[model samples]
Target: MNVLDLLEQWKQSDTFNNTLSDDHQVISYQEAYLRISVYSDWLASNSFTQPMAFYCAQSIEHLLMLIALMFNEVNFVLLPVKSTDVDKELFADQLTLKPHFCDMLRHIQLTKQAQCKTVATPGRIYFKTSGSLGTPKLVVHQRHNLIANSRNVLTRLPLNASSRVLIPVPMHHMYGFGAALWPCLLVGASIHLTSNLNILRFKAVERQFAPTVAYLTPSTVGALLLRSCKSSQYEFIVSAGDCFDRQTFQQAQTKFGRVFNLYGSTELGVVAIGEIQSKGEAVDDCVTALPGVKIKIESEQIAVKHPFGFDFYLYQQTRDVFFNTGDLARGDEITGFSVIGRAKLSINREGRLIAFSELESQIKQHQHIQDVALVKGRKDSKGHTIVAIVESTTELAPDELRRQLGKFLPRYATPSKIIIEPQLPRLVSGKINRKQIALHYEETEF
Candidate 1:
């Protein structure tokens, strides 16, 4: 259903009383709709045809403006909720956006105007892909794509009017918007959106409104698990990002009842939902595909096609019927499928191509290592070399890490350089900033 229809249906039913709480205040569905309408009316009057990018204010108003724009011209790009100048210049050649959107306060101030009502203008929503292997690209989708994808999630997950979801991820990212916001809004479920995620802040939220489902990243999950909160109201723990190793997954399932590692891309909303297995069931990283979604391995890359999947990538100049998610995956009848790594992250060393993420996963198996990131260093005469940056819970030596990885991976996949650090850098969406890490080690020698 369309957003307006969804909101109207909720208003007509008992769901209108359901709450949408942020860090500061709590408001009911009807209350939020009134606020959103005020912003949307302003957008509908200002005419625009070209796609425009946005900077996040990280408030209830940002969401209101997005909902408002969706009701109007529909074509707007969300630059990954990060405060960067690149987002400002993305549509520079195409659209003229007056009054740059900086990080203001809770509400967005749009100069209001009145124009004659027009037909509902529908357009695409472009989200920035995680720039793990290379430069980030935009994934173009529509409101229907988001609605269909959220419906798929709602169909799979046990969510209803009574469900309360915790949304810690940024609203600008597809994971937070498509996975958290749309599903919660469409299903008439309440959401507890936190401005900050920490021991004191989250504990406060838990005391006020007990969250049923937590859609968080592995990093956030790790931090949350360490907290001494006396609450156990979490029924489902949803996580994405490559950092979800077997150890993290099992620990989450132990604490929270059911933990599902959502395997998805911004291009294809959510392809599979792998129930993070317990201690040992011969963990195979098997993720079951959603209905009506087709998956295949072309040139060893995971290719997907679904109704919810977007067709073109405007920035990359890629137009395809099947979105070839440069991710490397393996599937069979028994094991289903497993997403291993990205095709762009593969390092060709001595004619053997090794996925950096796959190699990093193998290294993370070493008990002492807390986190790992693999980056491609400068190419010497032998070829491109791999660098492993380790974040260990306990003390770890580089030589010992290599000795451990030698048992799990081949020599070609082994990191030529190991940099020890207290923590690994991450993007807003919880994906490793492999782009940044790669640039860091690129200037150094092995």
Candidate 2:
């Protein structure tokens, strides 16, 4: 269903009283739609003939403006940075939304209009991929397709008007926007959004909002487990953006009753979700593809063709029928498939290819280690050396870690050098920032 139809359905429902909230304030669906109506009217009055870029933090105002922009059929790009931080010269062609306070309609301001070839299409939504591996690029999606992707999520985890969702991730990211927010809105669920959530803040929010569902990252799950908060069980919880090791998955399932691992990419919206195993069974990593989505393991890399996948990257119109997601996977559609690691990040060692994700998972098994990240170092006679940076509960000498890894891993698979730290660098989505880690250890001798 389109957003307008969804909103109309919400208006006729008993849960029109259900609320959407941010750290700033709480407003019912009635109030939210009223504000959106006002914003839409104002946006319609203004004749916007050019493409625009919107850069705002995750707030109710940001969401209202986004809906209003779409409502008025004004094509715009959703930037990942705040307006104040954006480089005006770089995006001079497209109009830009000026920074504003809470008032969405009154505070609307746009930069001087100019031609922008990248965002020529009207009635489209745009997002930028997190440049963890390289430079960030704009990803474009059809507005209707985005809604369709959200519907795919419902095939697995259904929501209701009574559902209360806690979203701590940034709305600019696809995980938060497409997977969580749109689905919640479609079901008229009570929503509460927060930023930079830690265990203490999480507990406080839980008590205040009484959230029945949450969108979380692996690191956030680790923090909740670390605190041993005895958090109340909910309908279900979703963990995505990166893979979760077996131990974390088991602990989360025990604590949360039902924890689902979502396997998707910025390109393909909600591809598949890990199937829920029967009670008392070990948690499985294998995920089944969502409705109308095709998945194949070609040359060990995951290839996807989703009805709701993004159209193309900015300035790059040509696209393959089946997008080759750089992630490696094994298994099939019937039994389900397991996403292993990034295809580009796999390292060759002594005629053997080792996935860094598998290597880190093995290193995390060490009793002293809390987390691990593998970085590809300079090539040696045997192969490219691997640098292992570990976050440990207690201080572990480099020699001691090597000795412990030697017991489980083959000699070629063990890290050539080890760096012990209090914590490993991570993105907000909980994926390791390998580029940052490599830059930090560039000068060190192995």
lDDT scores of the candidates, listed in order:
0.68, 0.75
lDDT of 2 by residue, 1-446 (tens): 44478678797666789988887778888888878888787776766545577775667777777877766667777775543333343343343343343454445556665644443567777777755222466787888898889988988886788889999877778888888988888788999988888888888788888888988876577677764644565777887755555666767766676778788877888899974454344445678999999888877788898999999986788899889988888888666888776777666554345777767777888889889888887765445788888887676678888888988877988888888888888999998777898788743545
On TM-score, the leading prediction is 2
lDDT of 1 by residue, 1-446 (tens): 54588677686656888888877668788877886776666566656434555554445556666676666646667764443434444452122122223233223433222231222225777777654333466667776777789889876777777789888877777778877787887777888876568767777777888888888776666666674433468788787765355655666766777877777777888887777665464455568778788777766687777788775676555666777777777774235677766677676554244667656667887888888887777665335787788887566677777777777666767787778888888899988787788778763754
Model 1 worst lDDT run, 10 consecutive residues: 92-101
Query: How close is each model in CA RMSD to the real structure?
Result: 11.7, 10.9
TM-score of 2: 0.74
- Per-model clash counts, in order, read 0, 0
